[model samples]
Target: MAGLDFEPALAAALTRHVQGITSVGKLTRLSGGASQETFAFDAHTASGTLPLILRRAPGGSRDGGSGQGTALATEARAITAARACGVKAPEVVYVLTPQDGVGDGYVMERVEGETLARKILRDKEFDAVRPKLAYQCGQAMAQIHQADASQVPELRLVTGPQQLAEYYERYRAYDLPKPVFEMAFAWLKPRIKEPKRTVMVHGDFRHGNIMISPKTGLAAVLDWEIVHRGDPLEDLSWICINAWRFGVTGKVVGGFGDVPEMLAGYRDAGGDAYTVEDVRTWEVMGSLKWGIMCMGMYEVFRTGYDRSVERAAIGRRSSENEIDLVNLLIG
Candidate 1:
């Protein structure tokens, strides 16, 4: 029931929200999300039939050490803040809080777009659209950074140095003897002196995290679990990281465009204070951070906190991509 039991409650909730709404049916879980559960459903309402998405933390049981609560709240707040800032985020219909006895979840409009990285990079239908997406990604990120932080106080959850420190602590807590990652950690400590500027960073900004339409290019930026305050360049570098290039490594900037175009777009969109050096440094950090985090996800799967074959596979991907970081630093 925990996995697919939300149907009855969801139907009741929908009925209350939409007058004369009734007969909600065909709720099914969607794939691709390992940290949380997502479902798409159709509902019969007096207004009309509707398609919606429901996102909630994985089950209702909160593992003592997994930082799931903060993550859930962070994503909900990010969706709200992004919409208020004029960013292209899915419209949030309702935020289910803990007190609601519905677990932590949210209902939103199901946006139509493709989130597959390779598909976006290879699809001929997006030939014209893809070229301009990098710049648009930059512009959208700039807008998110410019969002009033006060509206989303959760952005202050971590700062520059604390951000890196927290990741190290998480890895250490796992007690995994990762020599390469240890070296990367040592390299990151000194580099964390101070950022040139502080802004909201979409912690996991990259090609796969964005949804793009074959015709319109970037439709909306997804995955807000890691949203926090830090160097604006962190977001830029993250998108350009090689792992996200999806076989188009030579293109550099998310395989959609070049760095100059991305930087130029960000600069024109009021990110003038950002510098190339700043973004480069963060790019290195981005690679290391994601590599380590990928390992953490695998740990979660292995430890039975979450048992998903997809997560185990993702964990194995960290090593190959971390090497890219080593090369970037030494070469």
Candidate 2:
């Protein structure tokens, strides 16, 4: 479906859904999406041009396998519910149907901001707003967790121990073992305790998934495919993972600010009272989780399931996570 024509179907859908719309214009595919297809286009209307985005599954199919996260309709519902909770999420304009001729996905308002982590961390244009990003991220995360579970579509309830067992099994399935990973698992198993309460957590609340503006800081949180109901601390710790720092390891919170500042923002936004130690424990789990995911990438590449150079490149970074784990645990 790479070269499939979407202009005709888009024109029909936009004209019908969007009031005073004429046709679609200048559809361009955006990069950096590994699982889904994303396209940006203009919906020319009688009033003015509307910037919109189309996120669809490849070949117009609805399913993306078991580990691929939720379906498109569920993702759209999550976005809508997050927006209602005051989180900076994209407006879900329309969800695509089979009769629409477009793929099984949704159309959303195109948010103008930077989603690249390296550029956001290193670029001079983002200098002024960089320091505030971590705290803002915490605030945004608080809003996401505050969303009513009933308002959003039903999501899987994944506890810390359940996630640990699941990922550990995934790691062992590849028949590859590392002392660092085994040790990390052992360290995490005993510490795994049931959460006193659960909330909607943004499963992947790291750098690239967040949109940052040069002016107002956090613009919107993108990529709701992996959102789930779980401990809110998972969102806090996932951002502190070393891999998300993008080489600025000194700044513990997404290469921008310290943990205290992030917590301050979290508290200001009415989040649960959590301490640094709580986040650190989850950080260790997050590091090991990422390491196993990297190994999975390599396994797919080696088994000829995915032959892309990008997968091979990411697979090589599994060792870096091990080094991070050693420093975090052994030190």
Best by lDDT: 2
- lDDT for model 2 comes to 0.87
Q: If scored against the real structure, what TM-score would every candidate get? A: 0.86, 0.95
Show pairs that collide, candidate 1: none
Candidate 1 lDDT over residue span 126-154, tens digit each: 88798898789888888888877776775
lDDT of 2 by residue, 84-147 (tens): 8899988998888888888788889999999899999999999999999989988998899888
Residue 247 local lDDT, model 1? 75
Shift of residue 297 alpha carbon in model 2, Å:
0.6
Error of 2 at 71 (Å): 0.5
lDDT for position 216 in model 2: 91
- CA error at residue 195 for candidate 1, angstroms: 3.6
Top candidate by TM-score: 2
